[model samples]
Target: MRQQNHKNTFLKTIPFTSIFVEALKQSSMWVSSNYIDGNSQFQGKLLLKVDSQWESVQLNLHPEKLYRKGVGSDDYTSYCQLQACFLKKFTHFDPTMPNYRYGIRLQFGQQLSHLLCENSDVFKKWFQFLRRFCIMDKFARKYKVLGKIKQCDPVFGQCLFSCVRVQDAEYHVVKVIDKNVITAGQKQNLYRELSNLRKLSQTQICYIVEVFEDEQSVYILYEYYLGIDLRTYIKESQIYQMAEQSSQGLDEKLVADILYGVLQAIQHMHSKGVFHRDIKMENLFIPEKKRLPFVVLGNFCYSETTDSTQYKKCGTPGFVAPEIFRSKNYTSKVDLFSLGIIFYLLVYGKLPFEGKDQEEILRSNEKCDIDFKFEKKICKKISISGMDLLKGLLNKEPIKRLSAAQALNHHWFIKMGTRNQRNQYLQVQRGKSLSTIIENSVDITQSYYQSNSQLYQSTKEDDKLDRVEKEFIKGSLYDKLLYFNSIQYQPSKIRRIQQST
Candidate 1:
């Protein structure tokens, strides 16, 4: 009977001889699971087929042995060893069984880095999880595994997680998407642009969401934050929540703090020659703790500038600047105008130029009438000075609107608290003295303008226009050239001038 059992075991192991040999030759087959505090219990396979599933084979994985992978040592043996662990799990299983699989579920206590670190197989598994959850389509939408949320408006988005372990490595999987559709190339381009921007900005305005393509659309994987946004902070009165009920809503000082951080972020982008065409309350994210909230500006589909513009006519209607609708030549000031609107919203829950119709709103923009009634009633409790600062930002004309930096210097902010001086903050890194910080910020702004000036100049060289020639032949080829060269690519002046004449 024992001999028959041995013969059966040998026959079964014959098909998986390579994996058995690999286990013998390699030593790092098992590793300690430190990422999650729980003991590394070998959870069996997730069934891929209707019934075939993984059977757990108890193997001890060592910590030092696992560290020997992409922190790179010539651990070809480790690779084989890891494979062997999977093979061993399937050793006793019947291949013909409807449920025969091999995969180990690595559970962790908490903390994201545990899943992201060191072990190559583990990292790859984690990345796979991200792809499956955050970037996969069939699972997120088709299955509706991640339900929808109203907060992700104009476009709704969703996310989920899956975990895996190979040796000492921990792996995590996350998925994300917009309710509307998107293409692969569009996803790639947008993700690349966002990745580049995240590295470029010194401030936390940009929050990077890891996105990849799956099927017809792209999926975005990100860390989940159960934090509040600046809008919520203002609305919920966080200060009041912390056993301080007397302090409700946003105060002048708090508003300044928020604006300072926002401006720094916008300034950082402008310096890069990339304009955030859409800047609004919903786009920004803030954590509940002491850490500052960063603006997560989105909807680059309609972004435009002197050198780059897409006439997609995108943006929230009320928040969009006047110039976008007017067909007038415009620049980064459009964003400033949007920022002004946000500033108004931050101070007063209602918009400054509300109207029953589009025509009425346009008229309001022309009149620049910012009523003080709300500010008088609500903001008086915060600071009259804060109200004035908001008024300065809520200027109707883009020209008259406060430049992001100038807004930082308003009397209300200056008196609120000791903030990093604008110039220092731009030039030096974070954690410097207030005055130095301000100077650093100014220098950074100056450097940005300088860099952008050079970039714009280069872009112009390829698509340069002879302004004089254009005006001279304003009715002919010259007009055509200017219109063609424009980012919007519309023959705007010719038709309008012709009609008027």
Candidate 2:
């Protein structure tokens, strides 16, 4: 099969997580079989189709998400975590009877459990999805799921995984969204965006490589790039610490470097008449391969052409342009306004505006009265030219705000950054810094959120906001342009699991 693993086996040493066992969002697709580990095998029904039901046991497996075969059974209170499963697909099969064609022998320590699936197609899916929880030596074998890149987003029913294409051994970030949860409109929007992204892939610096959909889900694959999102980068960097001390804004040079690449990316989109309504730090990816911070803009869920009119009130609250709130007729300048928010963060070491919750933040954003309570102190951190660029981009009036192209030509870029820094950013190359803050840091977002702990947990008033954002804002089909103030788009990269000491 073209969609098959190299050895048809996972390395025996790779450790697995219990994510699959814990996430019971979908059916278990398991049946207790008498043919399992010794006399402990209990009888149960596999949810095979009622029209052609067969008395057999079957299961879906993957290393990262180890399936507990006997979970949710009244008789079998204990969980059966699959340690190593020996899968044998019989060449011969029969639909008339339970003459098994697929054989799966699962081993859990000293405990052994065996399952037989009647359908060959279902059996293949079981083997494929249950492939690996870790990387492969040969660059994670293409089309093979190496491991989960991130947990499922509660509101959107989407998650990310790291997969590899076998032929070229290129790693990809697979965005899996459950088709059952989203609305038809959202699905169409997704398909249309994916199509647009494909056409732009050849020209754009970074974009989704391909998209695939089946009966249950949509998978959008992105080329694997090392580094973290700007949101996480800010929170984990010395910036957060400095902010706590009410320290000065970062170096104007670094701030300019961080924004240079992202601006060019937005400029390219705007030139093509596309407006990325969502330009928050979470949507901006900074590659860590070089000291110079290179940025990649992603997540076109809210992006639309200049002519297309929708999601007028759609965007992350604090970063959204004021024109978006004033009128639905906002132009591509909205993106430049959002970019201004990122600039404010890089300079001030915190968001430009803040409130107890989303409503307050949106109100603050609408006024476009940048909270310069500490403007005097902040003025010391950034140059007059730098502050001028920030104010220009963030201008509430779309007609007045600087365009992406203009922002590139702004004196701040020319004055604060070298000619090489300004031009070299368009292409992913060297430079130290924003080039933004790069770190081998802990899952800072994870630390912030322990119990459904949302990002930037220092603020408790945001609990209601987090719940609303995570639960889909009451009957909304599409995931809102979330205004949680602290919800970071957590993306994990493939790292070797260190051998336990």
Best by lDDT: 2
lDDT of 1 by residue, 363-473 (tens): 676455666554222322444345445555555556755666666554345445536543333233333333333233211233433433321221222223334422322
**1-501 per-residue lDDT for model 2 (tens digits):** 521342244223223322222222322333344332221222323332223343333332322223333434433322333312222232323455455556444432222344455576656655443332211122223378878755343235438787888777777788777756876666556644543453343222455654443445556677675367777776677565664466443555767777777777788777666777888877776665644366677777767777565555778988888877767777888888888888777765568778899999888888878753344333235654455567667766676666787677654464465447434442332232221211111111222124222222222322323354334222122232232112321111101111211
TM-scores for every candidate against the unseen true structure: 0.46, 0.53
Candidate 2, RMSD to the unseen true structure: 21.5
Residue 100 displacement (Å), model 2: 45
What is candidate 2's CA lDDT for residue 262?
76
Model 2 — TM-score against the truth? 0.53
lDDT, candidate 2, equals: 0.52
